[model samples]
Target: MATEKSGTVGKALGLLTLLGDYPEGATAGQIADAVGYPFSTAYRLLNTLVETGFAGYDRREKRYRLGLRIYQLGQKVAHHRGFEGAAVPILQRLTDLTGESSILAVLDDDRFLTVHKVDGPQFRTTTDPGDRGPLHTSALGKVLLACTDPATREHLLETIELTPRTEHSITDRAELRRQIDQVRRRGWAGQQEENDIGMAAVAVPVLSASDRLVAAVALAAPIFRADQEALQAHLPDLRRAAATLALELPLRA
Candidate 1:
């Protein structure tokens, strides 16, 4: 009985998660197929969600989507998380010192998700908060990969699709492993036009008080303005900011 109840709860949560991913909304049949639940079951669950204001259904489109309640809850969680409070000032300081855009990112499953950014007055990057990037190319991604446990890193490297975003992107798994090893040895990571043609970036890990990797702090600039050497030169300041951020983060064990 307990197992049956747990499975039902899991399925309901899975449906909600799937709905959250489809911002444009999806039909009951589509949701049922996606979650591998019976059509009737999916419809019932979606109706229940709608009744609770956790989801909305469009009669004209015959589609279901996450509702205002989810957005409100997400905003509340984001405020309580204090990620912006802890990171914005550091990013601003780093950007001021380096004369480049500074970004804070966290590993989100197989991708790196930028959470905060501060652009230098002279230039700005295309990356923005909520943007997701591949793990093998970006400096922030490399720093995150380097800081993960060996087993987790190996699993991610093997499982993640190594799509080349640009000519400099490392599509070769062995080469990516080598680069991650270098990042581990150097305590930071860098990329020169790897993810984009005219951009360069360097990143250092932000570790918790217990020395657990929590996130990465990165600085990006136009390749003409800052080469790898120039980016590396800013490491001391970046590391200092990262240290301060680590202290500020409320990481859980």
Candidate 2:
């Protein structure tokens, strides 16, 4: 029984790998061809994936895409830290001052997770503490990505396929590398609807006293409230707050 279970796990992993390679998704026949499994076996495995919430079938497209359950699992793993609670008051202050949603994000494996968020009283926003977004499309992700070593950044680029979340998303590796360089030089990052239409964000890196990158803070608002000029105007405040938080973080050494 144990051997049978292991074999089944291997087959499931192969199916998932095949699905991941095709972001638009694939039919059972395509997946079977890629995995070199019999069509009947592939069909059974696909059904199991859909039943277990690891994959979903789109009737319109007749293809299988990754399901929300995977995202929920990733989010669950990313929000395991208790330190996020400590950042709430600071996040609240940023929201109170800027009238935009303040977010605290931590870098996960090639992704960014919002660990804490304070919504502005003026308007309701979609982000929550466990919201997960891609590294290339988010202001918070850019700030954290910039703080990493160049080699690690390259590895991250090589591992994850960048998707165009919006027209402004930096999908090209070269452009993303250039943007990260600018973020490092400027000490902050800004995104104008890079991930969502009519939404904008600005981020600053929080570093430990030993200069290790710890986390990032971001302010998100609608385009009308967070235009390019407004994002630039708030840069100083965001940087100051990040610096203050950095000072409070425990030293790595």
Candidate 3:
């Protein structure tokens, strides 16, 4: 039999899940109606969530939304599921198709952070879990930048140092912006020896059910084995894998 405390906890969690579905946030009355809880009980639970930082209440909007704390917890959950778990098979399949290394990356502040990687028989990439790279020099980063909001993208481009990783790296702000614009139009991004000499890569955005960009899946290879054209040729396969991964992985936002 469920105790009173356990029942309350269950209801609170159900309410939280419902709140997640509405990223724009909802009111206490809406949450109560959705969860079938009493108005008073729902209000108490929302206050608890806000105090704990699990949810935030906007004073001006008078709506409750998932807080930064929830985002932090989600990131930890994603990392736990990434290595040798949900993302492995997809990465392995990409590597198999391209005969190159494949990577899964998420936006980490102003940079792209690799979460998982699978190497093909022909070559292995240096990227690994916790490794971060600039958004202007790598295919995965470019896709992420392209999918971000215009204001946030501009802030990142202006603040983050665009150090030249190689002669091919785009250090000019206008040029990089144009490149990201192209990425948005093409639905994919590619780099030829930009992040590292002799390394070429192509990436596709992994979007959630709500069409929000959550992560990216990329194929990387040695320039000698696969140039930009070769990477572009494998985009169809990469996009398919990315689509599957988007459904499998939890939504970051």
Candidate 4:
């Protein structure tokens, strides 16, 4: 029994290494081949990972992928302070200035999680806090993706499988990478009728004092009301708000 347990641990470690090497993830057979392990052993380990929340499976493709648990563990270590407590007031100010709803979001696990949000008046439009959207489909998600380190970004893209939420959603990996580069160059990202038809959004990344990206701030409104001039006009305030949040975010040691 002891020998069997030791062998299992070794196999699990080998599986993790394979995943780390290939961020785009691997099939059961591919993982087995990568680790040079027996097919049955690799299959068992993959099944155990899915059962324990250490990996995810794509129902459509029938492939194994890394789960949110790895990201959750990283978040625990990366962000020790509560994000909402420090960022809510800043988001409120953005709403007060722009009259559009503001979202304070962090890249949670494998998805963007809204930690705080400030709603605008009845005339304004909004989405809910705690709403989860595809990274390739939302402005806030794009900014977060664009601002992070390149190696990590590539790793994330590998782990991510883009699902077309709408016709405007970026389904092509190369196109998404090109747009992300544009966001990095311009210091902001925008989505027009991408995730939701008739809705539009602009987002900028909040960087901590240590220069690590902490979250993204976004202003969302009806697409008809958010023309190019209006979006460009709001950019300064948006950038300022992100910078303000960055200043307030605790420097994780």
Top candidate, metric lDDT: 3
TM-score of each: 0.69, 0.66, 0.70, 0.65
Please identify model 1 stretches exceeding 4 Å from their true place. 1-84
Give lDDT tens digits, candidate 1, residues 1-253: 9998898778878989999788788999999999989999999889988887678787878889886556446645674575465579878888877788998887766788777788878787877666778999999999999997677788997888999999889989999989999999989999998999999999999998766888899988888888877989999999998998888865521
lDDT of 4 by residue, 1-253 (tens): 9999998988897787677676666788998888888899899999898887678776556678776566456445444454445677888888889988888777754578665777766444445455566788888899888878777688877778788878988888889989988999998899888878787888988888666888899888776677434676798999899889888864321
TM accuracy, model 1:
0.69
User: Residue 19 lDDT in model 1?
Assistant: 92
What stretches of model 2 exceed 4 Å from their correct place?
1-84, 247-253
Q: How much is 24 displaced in model 3, in angstroms?
A: 12
Please report how far candidate 4 places residue 151 from its true position, in Å: 1.9
* lDDT of every model, 2 decimals: 0.84, 0.79, 0.85, 0.77
lDDT by residue (tens digit), candidate 2, 1-253: 9999999889987898778787888998999898899999999988899888688787667898675557456556655653345677787888888888888777655788676788888776667766778988888999889987577677886777789987888889889889888999989888888888898888988887666787899888888876755877888788777887676644321
Clashing pairs in 4: 24-158
Clashing pairs in 2: none
Give the total clashing residue pairs for model 4. 1
Per-residue CA lDDT of candidate 3, range 1-253, in tens? 5698898888778878888898888999999898888999999999998887688887778999886556556656766675376888888887877688899998766788787888868777878666778989999999999887677678887787889999989989889888988999989999998999999899999988777888999988888898988889998999899999988987764
